[model samples]
Target: MSALPGLDDCVHCGLCLPVCPTYAIDRRESQNPRGRIAALRAIEEGRSAPTPGLLRGLDDCLVCRACESACPSGISMEGLMMEHRSRTSDARSDGRTVAERWFLRAVVSSPGVLDRFLGVARLGRSLLPAALLPDTPGPSRLRPARAASPPAATSRLSTETKGRAVLLRGCIADRVQDRETRLAARLLSHFGFEVSISAPGCCGALQRHSGLVDLARELSLERARDLLSGEPDAIVVDSAGCGSALHEPLSDAPELHAVAERGTDTPSLLATIGLPPPPHPIPGPVVFAPPCHQSHGTRSTEATRSLLEHITEGEVVLLPGEEQCCGAAGTYFLRRPAKSRQLGERAKERWERGGRVKTLATGNPGCLLRWESLLRREPGVEVAHPVTLAARAYGLESEER
Candidate 1:
């Protein structure tokens, strides 16, 4: 039997159990990191085959990597899990539906196609279920006027330019969260940074989590080439998931090392550049839900909090369960609706307990969408990226309706 790579890294210390969301939810050993690693070791040694139960154990994982943060052994849990998924072809097929596969392979991989489909989805939104439509019909102002332009070189250096960054207009972000994307660019530019918006299509984070490793690799390589073609000071990503995906180690494409090294979340980038005090500090408390990718995956929890604090004059409350997964691990909500809702409800309950807050800011698009679905009916409670709030504080009005 062949050895599973990185399986030996886990020392069975049980440190990951308490922080594991699935374990916290189910109280099952199989749902925890140590147990999952043990199971992977067993399979590698031919002690077990990939059974339905085993697959369920693996699929149920949020892959949020919170456990990795807690692990004392410094295990590369994400890499191990992805490698396992990549090796198990059957797992990929079983985890995703034909339609899901088509969407990732065809729709998401091409920005123009996805934009067209979303436009039609918007028209028929009233006819569709609440679950099918986005929390709000995206502002008409945000709809892409045309397909995203290709990744062409844009050298807009000025003596005043502090740095240069290329914005990743991800597939879903390009359509649904266009206002945030635009605001992020505006804010960066305001800070004396040259900003170039590029269509890298999708970052392949969704595909990797869905067990479509082949597609994930292909998309990663393509994005690496597109983003790294010309040297930029930073590759700015507003979505935590996209930023983390871009940061994933692409051993095959060593050329991308520089780009991956430069990849940063929007909030972190602002922190590095030094956020100027908001011209008009937004009134009332600002509650932040740090996405798992940002908090746990990238370890930018403190940096995110600092940025939020700098932008709002009111109390900046880090939501109590900031480290917990919001259950919107990319398409996890759509794939495992029951668990997703359970976790999202728990997160919302935590937010509610935090007292009256005017706005809720988070780093990931999926987290924003999930919260919007939950809070859209609540009235006056706005949810957005922290950078959006910062942009507003800097006197930039949202073009959003």
Candidate 2:
């Protein structure tokens, strides 16, 4: 419906060819970035509409932005797709079932509502038979919340130089993997910054990705304004996907422009600060499946790898492949379970081929959840976030006796 960034910037560059997972999957021009842009242009000019074929090319994209990074002319493939999503008909919105829409709206917009929902779900899970829970291939929607009290802080920051950092206590991580956030706070405080978990809610990355543009922008600006009052030195988001989304424009919020100017990912922040990781080794062999966002989307795997190498005993293996995606694209597993499973199996097979890796480390929460499900169902596999492993290795958490 609108003219995208002019196509002249693409230059028919073949540099992005080998890096595109869709192209690698089918070796079709239509599956690649250049062709997708062409199709978008044609659709805009009324040469064509959303055909199954044209939509396939656009939908196949993981929005990893690897092509943007690879481009000689600086094409913004991710930006283009986000725009396309806004202009496209609601009918084409992927997997936007009524239940999914309501679920996301309640959970993301209001943290209190989400917490209460979790309480109900947890109680239901306890009363219901295990068979009643959907045997989905992704992260189990039901994980028990911390019933007991949280641990007390062992130390405090100095009075003269008290600093604050707001953690994005994400919806998924807060409910399912809260321990990761706890570990993160410990690590940050160890490095001399007082950390506080941001009020529970979503950052609207999911809405943005799913073409809920107004929701995404609205929620983002609200979160930014709230966090700004805390006057944090930095907003440290541990989830790579959330962190990446925070880097983009915040719709039309003039107030948030200054605050968002300082957003930073955990790994990127660590790299900038040059924190010294302990000279210790993890107990077992570990392989990393860097989030497609960290690997291809943001290219921040170097920071992750460096941190891993610092505190591992056995060899740390980086699996060889396209590093395209794990297919747990946020709620992608729920929406496209079959395709997500295909990609997950492909990743698992590749990991096994590298000779029996005991643990798999990744940065994104979705990847952590999906991989956990894969490992739980499959015998003899362990998957966790890299930060969890790092926190343990650094002697931060007391190991269970």
Task: Name the TM-score of candidate 2.
Answer: 0.85
TM-score (C-alpha, index-matched) for candidate 1: 0.90
List, in order, the clash count of every candidate structure: 0, 3
Residue 232 in candidate 1, Cα distance off native in Å: 1.4
For residues 121-183, write the lDDT of model 2, one tens digit per residue: 777766776556532423254454443333346443333333677777666666766777677
Q: What is the alpha-carbon RMSD of candidate 2 to the true structure?
A: 3.7
Candidate 2 C-alpha error for residue 256, in Å: 3.3
Per-prediction TM-score, please?
0.90, 0.85
Residue 44 of model 2, lDDT score: 80
Give me the overall lDDT of model 2. 0.69
